[model samples]
Target: MIHQSFLDLDYCARVSGCETCRTFRRAFILEQITGRDVEFLTNPDLQSPVYAVLRIESSGDRLLLTSTPTQKPSFAATVALNHEPRHLANDPTKSGARLTTDFQELRRVVRDCHDNHECSSRYRWSRRNPTWLLEIMDNNQVRLVRGPKSLVDYVVLSYSWGDPAEMPAAEWARIKGAGTKTRNGIPVPERLNPFSAWDLPETMRDAIDITKELGFGYLWVDNVCIPKGTNWDTEASLMHEVYGNAAFTLVASSSSKATDRMIKERLAWSHRSKAVKLRGKWLHNTQMPLDKIRLESPVARRSWTLQEERLSPRVLYWTEQRWYWSCPESQVAELEELGHVRPENKSMERRSPQLFLELCRTGDIEQLHEEWLDIVEAYTPRDLVEPRDRFLAIAGLAVRFYSAKSEAGGSFISEEYLAGLWRDNFARHLAWSVAKGANSRHNLQHIAPSWSWASLPLRMETKTKHAFKPSEHFRFISVVEEKEDSEKAMTGPNFTSHDSLSRGRTMEERGRGVKVVDVEGRFRRFVSDNAKQVSWDAIEWRRGKRVGFDFGAFPGHDLFARHEADGRIIAKDAHSGEIVGQLDYVVPDEALKSPFTPYVPCGGEKEIMCLELGESAMLLLVRNPSWGHQESYRRVGVAISYENRKGFFYGCETRTVRLA
Candidate 1:
């Protein structure tokens, strides 16, 4: 009979070579079960503990036994001895026997029998697909088995254990050792691909030896040599590498020069459009007080907050080539992706005739020597020509040369864009001269040549005294410098004011056949006999105020409005104080002996001429004008000073009038 604990290693070790194994052997034989049983083995010399194994019979009934005796070998002490002799009569360890023991040991015996059969070499079909090829015993390790050859590849057992994929590709290659990939016989160096544009400057240096010598490494211009077919995404990704990496950019200012010539040709092909019709257009009067006209409306300066291309001309150099009047960097990236190369080597690039004419006078004579000869050949000096004329003529040529390039398919930058770029770049210069206040604005006039206008009339010589002057038709607004040195301060006003009360007019051309009407009331305003209102007294000009006048007496009368005949009027602020000063407008006629003659007096007459003016668009002091004391006008309401000599008086000139 078999014991319930027959397969237990410790229990088997106590029984294998002892009387229990002999008893089990006899019992299994009596039952005639398949297989022989094996005894347990122990290494006595190695001092290793014991484990059990089985010896199978010819029919495969396995006999489990221990090599050592349990409790020093006593047949009567065996677990099977407790069963009665009758239990042994049926051979209880066997399923068909009448004698019975626990089912647990019996099931193990059956399972082991099946396992031995399946793993047996004679069962060759099992080799077709092995089951225990890989074994994950637990989280600590994995065991890969190939039958009896159980090999465990422990990743943690090796030194190189962390994630290798996270390492840089270059580092990976280095660790892997350098090797060349052969296409046919040609060997290509193995490398982790880098962005192409990052290497553009280096490529250019290798290609153009001359550029490499000219400090081109810092600002390489590749547009001339690099094909525009490169992918844009790659180019855009390399923007910081291209622009930020470079010291400065080279711009090709001549692209539009050729284009301008083409434009002229196109204009020639098409009929000319009619000139725009504008009324009441006349030259500004020199006799008009600067303080009065100082408040006149001016055309707005150009706006460039979000300009994509430079309005003014700027150059960028790269790749031994030059990109003239280049578009903004943001736009350039898009173009670069389109495969258009930027230009470079601008110091040697071809100059358009117009650009040569314009910028030729800007540099030193020695630096401009090459262009000097060309200028001398193109234009001859006129009689009594000012130095400015000579400079302008040379500058004109340069401008035309550059402009013509733009007219072609070149990247012609807009003049406005160029101007704005120059201004932003030279903002420090502006900050430097903000002092001298309004007079400092005059300093900006020299840079005016940068703003080239195609519509301005050009002539070789002027027949009139003012012939050499800027266009009289277009009033070039400038700040009139006041005696107050407030402009010298660092934080002084960026603007200037011409005070009518502090100065008076002095001009030789105050025409006769004109009558002046002082429109100074609680709201001080000024108007002429046949002209509109010109000046507004900030204090006197208020909402719901009116000044009426008569114009029927004058003949061939064209009213010269000083402030408001045709323009709209609206009170800018509320009125609350005593009417100390007034703003007035008048309709003056040329028939009057002198336009300066005042039609209103402060103390002499209670019926003073008052022409109510508009405050809708009047240019006022950058700061609110606060004349300390509120009092009656001394001589004439307030004197309109002519101040500077330019030309004719209009709706916004200053005039002197008596204040009561």
Candidate 2:
């Protein structure tokens, strides 16, 4: 017997698996698993929409699964109804109506996670004194005064700085004049008066409002927190600790510009697909996926915020539609209706801060490689207001990762930092490429070595399938670059890891390449077809190569892709005439050096320069003897060749090609 009709349904969105949805959807889900397709959903003549909202009268959090009376959902079909009301009469005041970032709900969510979660406590680090902090409630930037308060629990803000040039002249001038502003390229750090809240940007003011509402006294806004100086490079070193030790971070995900408001009116309905009703009621609104909600934002696309997001143990993300709080174990919202549905881990790498940190703590070396690759994918493809900060932006993360593994009881103590690539199976990280259809370019500032992904600005291809193995276990993988360890705190590297390089050589075969360790104990990367022996351009190889390359129209040199893309570029062996191996990226022709054809070994015509940090394809060689770094190469693009052990760069002399 059915006790409930599951009426009063709304917001049947793409990512909106709301509370009512789960219970109402249970009937449709079960029927599909055991019965036939839902007729109302598939009926052609109806041309009407179906919407459901589940209502349960239970004392406990869970539904009444086993009861004296059995219950299930009931569905009814009906036609469209126009003039649906959004109920925009009263002031929202961040209420349950729009799933606002209201304080009462935020407090409840925070209290619940703290009281019930284990990971919340374990994910924290020992508290430390913040370098410099903003008094959110007050309009002052002050250091620790003569008081017993040494360790302060501060809230941090992560937001897009927007284009400095376009900022209000008064605000930008005040910021620069306040102290050495990082964005305005102020190279000199000097003693200056503290800036008032009135001088700060709108986002910062909003963040301050949020911090104050959360009952925090001190706030850390990058530009304001750091003492005014061009020498901030040294001060930047403590960023990891600054964020790691914060009480929590407020991320303005929806704001693309500093002037834009973080909190805005919510869009509850869709205009794209017309609203048809079920049982002559309930409107339709597709749910946005959690990943899109987190990543598809202006702040998410900025490179510098990566460190801020990853290091903070707890974060309150303000997306376009609603507010979400994420900790080690859970990502919850303030919507009261959401209380009906239990949120489960979707296994999104960036969704959980502890995902990679846990790997470091447990000394999971093999898993760390894949996680780092994901970080690279997420970091690159983002637009940097000042490209010079490329390496500097991610330097904190590199330092944090290294520090984690080098702790007293950690693994890979021998792991060395070579530019952005790790020392272990250093060859595997060498395989990187712009996402298919994306483009790559040299960092005019030349912030990193040619061999390092830091040397370029490009969107790295995001890898979904796990093909990563312990590089120690691989035989053909390899680099030695004299890297500048996190400059006090930053760098300029745009890099990413592609799919698992072709299956590793047999245990014995992996060691086929030469091994030369100088005093540094670094492995030599075999140089493939160094100037003379290039066979990629050979007529035989060209004849065997067939093109399925989609390098022109992929999703905008994007970073942090959905689990949707797997672009394949295949290479063939003229001898076998068989579709043999995969190539991750091909530098387009415009970047190719003279005398080199697309078939000659690099990206096809339009031949853009590239670098290969090989796990999969053989890509661009980025080196310039002219820069005075002998035998050093700049990566034009990253590529890896798999399956065919003797592909383009196969069987070559092992040499350490320091990428610029």
Candidate 3:
């Protein structure tokens, strides 16, 4: 829990405190700046017998008033200084004084502090001489003086001089930016290059030289190259480029020469001779028990026996090189079959700077190259690049590790093949899927389709302007027309009139839209031929009822009713034994209706219902004279109308949902 404290401004003002009490009070006031606790003492300064008025001398430049003090009033006190502003009152020497110069308050303080003997006398001569020569002038214009020697002294005072010499300016500055700026007397370098060099340990000097000779212009040597002050942005950016551009990164294994020798002579040799054996019955073929095979037979003499089968050979191969096992494929399997106590080696799970540095010192660039290659080969490019791009490096690394395991376990597919597979699977389909995936993650609540498509890795078509190709991997399938393989096909009608109208620029612009799917099963086109139509049941909610079929709620409500020649209502209501209305007339597929009508309904209960035409035509409930809301309802139910167009809006679909 967070704690708080109260500031007794009244008590402080009455205290007529001395320097010590004043200091305590000042600290207390400052603590109040952040609404925190602070302790004050009225008798903190026992040395002085004067009972001076002690109060917060300044609060945003005004004194915090409290009870008056009983101390003898001197000329300084009687000056009414406390009644003036804080700046005027605080300085007894120049209370209420004003300057005509352009100097701001801070500069004024600096000038005052410099001119006042009391302030100037506070600084002491350095016991340790200044590294920088002094450049001082007593002119009134002069305040504080610092020279080159002082600069060097400042650097030295802030940093240490280790066994190594001064660091480059860029590196030192980098460290400073990284919030780890060190005190070592190091000059920060300003620029970085691939050819940058560092002071390597005497033992690794040769290795360092080799790296330079190999054309590495910018090298990252952690010890001397990365400054203690490197900024986070620069560090993060550099991390990517450093890991990618390095021809080979050198790892330091040991800090001392003696430890290096020990690793090579004693540790390396013992690890090389160790081995593991497999003695399981599976080694002898479990179906053919060892006892069943006759040892005396000539076949047995030439063929492998139980003893030979059980003896799985494994020889550590590290003596020839560094610390790494190099067992043959056969023995590797035997090691696994034995279970738990197989070949032993140090874990390579953690990244080791020491190990890396050791490799660098030994000039094992080849090993570094091979190991890096192994890492890349084991992980798919998508697995590596996508995660990296998305700021999910940790997850990416885990995926890479798993990929490595699969490769090591004898999978025939390479990382390259996996990348190719991803491309092939998603190439044609990525456009919509990628957008949808990102959108799904952006939603504030659970949305339709009830599935997250983002993680599915759906491929999109390269472009929407051209026809789709079989070579393309995936395409976004709209729920209504996803199974169809052709370009935006419309079922039911030609919509020759609508051909001139441009679809809205985007799905959002279309509002509640519709998708036009080609429902014509199998037929050839002829101008005189009747427009094809696929029969499907459309379920709708009835108006003024709990639920059930009615077309009044659909967009463009008075559709079939008034438009029919035999305009009338049909169907019984569920709640009450009354006609629900509908099916008064039906529009045939033959006659074409006017495509454009200025008489669009304003979508209110009082608007005139649409006029319908043709057999089994849809019905509508038109008022006696089409008036206002209060005098409503003569008919209601399924109302279909005649129109040549198929789709109503862009993203919206007109398809019926299957109840089965």
Candidate 4:
């Protein structure tokens, strides 16, 4: 039973001929449904007394009718709904109010995006099979389901996990067991028992309820859907497809943690009369803009969510004020001002990775290299829980770039991945220096070879401004051949050839080795001790056109201290005194007994190698100490190698040699 006494049916019929009267009638219906008083009035600017248009305004809600005299008389309205004050109380669920009156419009937007958006057809990675989804079953239960069948519509949840320690081990165990169940010690393919919504955290429970409300039966939540341990790496690699293929990605932007609720109550007020009198004239104060509210959300600032948002074809942002819809076609908010202004036909250019992919199609290797560098610079500062996952996290983006290239009939230069650097552009790619404000020491764990940028824990920048510039004088000799480790390969997704996913090997499992090359026929070798201590020493120096002068204090403590004081320890040119290169050094743990102190020499002899840059050269100090049965070298420091008045380097015969 419902109350309808508030409506005057006979009075509504008497003035039904008037358009304003009809508008008031519709407003009255809304008031009845929402339990809020609704009024119909003319536009404040309209001065006509006979047929001025009417406007609808409630205490905290607004519906602007778009009907003119010449236009058909219809009740088409643009509604701007906000959360009620009671919803914002400490207990959000305690309020019995409806979540929103704009649910129909939200559903329409999603349907349009799915049916009309071009991205849905272009990005079909998510359509592939063997993918997992969390199916919301009857009785408030959830079951993990896998698919190799036809395309199924599913929703994905994007949220921050906050502190990892807060995750319940029991919930994880239940999910793990639910994936596979056995009856009488025999495995069976049956749905797992349903779990109550109360069992889940607030953010996830809200997401599950929203999914069901939107007519979606399946949902994907990373923590619950993704398996733990070794499977984490394999599942992480599929993040691109998982998000991109989703029919809708629900962004819990306002929630700071997994336990935080996405839907909450907030005070809503009319912005039409919020103007203040300033200097005698009324000046309306612009409410907090929509973009500001969106960008400032907790999830937007996170590192992992960056890829998730960009990859998803359709994203529905749930904020405190109102809902926001973003897809390939357009971005719209409940508020008129927040809606996206349709762009010209060049919307495709705005699509990320697509833009990068287009660049790849042009065969502009230089531009591609530059774009890769930009991606690296942007991604380096993000926080990571495991340092070893640095390369794994970004591998999906690389896969997409290569996939686009292959589609354009472009051939890959090389299939081998050298840590983070590729062997195809070895010469230019190897010219990387430690970026400013990055860590100055190397990680003790052997994540990558010493020559690769991934070897050090610090952020890196390219030494040369132009990545594709030709180095005619340099020639690559040979790289040490290391076989992939089968044991480590099982820990993560393997990086195989682009054409054959089954044949590729993971970069983590690849053998460790250094690339050997020659500069102007002169073979220069960089030696290291266990890949951690890789450096070169300055054996000889020449000022101008004079013959080379050998310093008696070479490899000694006093000379090392003097060079360090002069700031030549890094890549400072001895002649011009310009800082051109960077270096990373890790001191041995003090607890361990070692023969040598910092910059202090033991009985071991030191060596040096010259690394030629464009117009300058870096003199690296290398130390090869015999510890046990292993022969290893450690990099101490680097100084600028000055050119003589005659030429940059003394003529030397080219020779081939192996470097470890």
Note each model's CA RMSD in angstroms. Answer: 42.8, 13.7, 33.4, 15.6
Q: lDDT per prediction?
A: 0.22, 0.47, 0.22, 0.47
lDDT of 4: 0.47
Q: Over the full model, what C-alpha lDDT does candidate 2 score relative to the true structure?
A: 0.47
**Sorted by lDDT, highest first, which candidate order results?**
2, 4, 3, 1
Using lDDT as the yardstick, the better of models 1 and 4 is: 4
Off by over 4 Å in 3: 1-247, 251-265, 270-473, 476-660
TM-score of each: 0.17, 0.62, 0.18, 0.59
Name the lDDT value of residue 446 in candidate 3.
18
Task: Kindly report which residue stretches of model 2 are placed more than 4 angstroms away from their true locations once superposed.
Answer: 1-101, 137-149, 164-196, 263-287, 336-350, 408-412, 437-445, 458-573, 577-641, 644-660
Q: Residue 643's C-alpha lDDT in candidate 2?
A: 43
**Per-residue lDDT for 284-402 in model 1, tens only?**
10111111111110100001000101111212211111111122211121012211122365542223212232232243322233343333222321111132232222222233323
Q: Write the per-residue lDDT of candidate 4 for residues 1-660, one digit (tens) a residue.
A: 011121332144234433233333333232211111121222233221222233346653443333343455322233333332112212211343244435666777777767777757765564563356678877787776665387788888887665444557764444334333445533234434455665667788889987887789988887656533325566655666777677878988657667766655321221111212322332221233434444456565445665666557677877654567776556765433233424455553433323443354455655666555555554554545566766666655555544444444434334345555554555555555443323333342256544555555533332433423433455555444434534444344434345522223244224222332222334343222212221234533667877343434333222211122222232221332222223444333342354432222321222444444333443343433433444333333332323332143336344332222
**Best-fitting candidate, measured by lDDT?**
2
Over 1-660, each residue of candidate 2 has an lDDT whose tens digit, in order, gives: 222322212234235545334333332322221011233333444333233223333431112221122233333321212235222222232233432445776877777766787644565655565655665435444332211146676788888776567677765555445333443543223313444554566677677777777777777877766644445444454566677777788888766666666654443322122223334344322223445545766677788887788777777777655577777666765442222112354454545655665665566677777778778778776777676666567655666666555553333245555556666646566565444523233433245553455544544544432453322213332332234522211232211111111111011111111121211112223231221222222212223566332212222221111111222322222232212222233344466464422221432212223322343434344334354535544344333434444233334344443443
TM-score of 1: 0.17
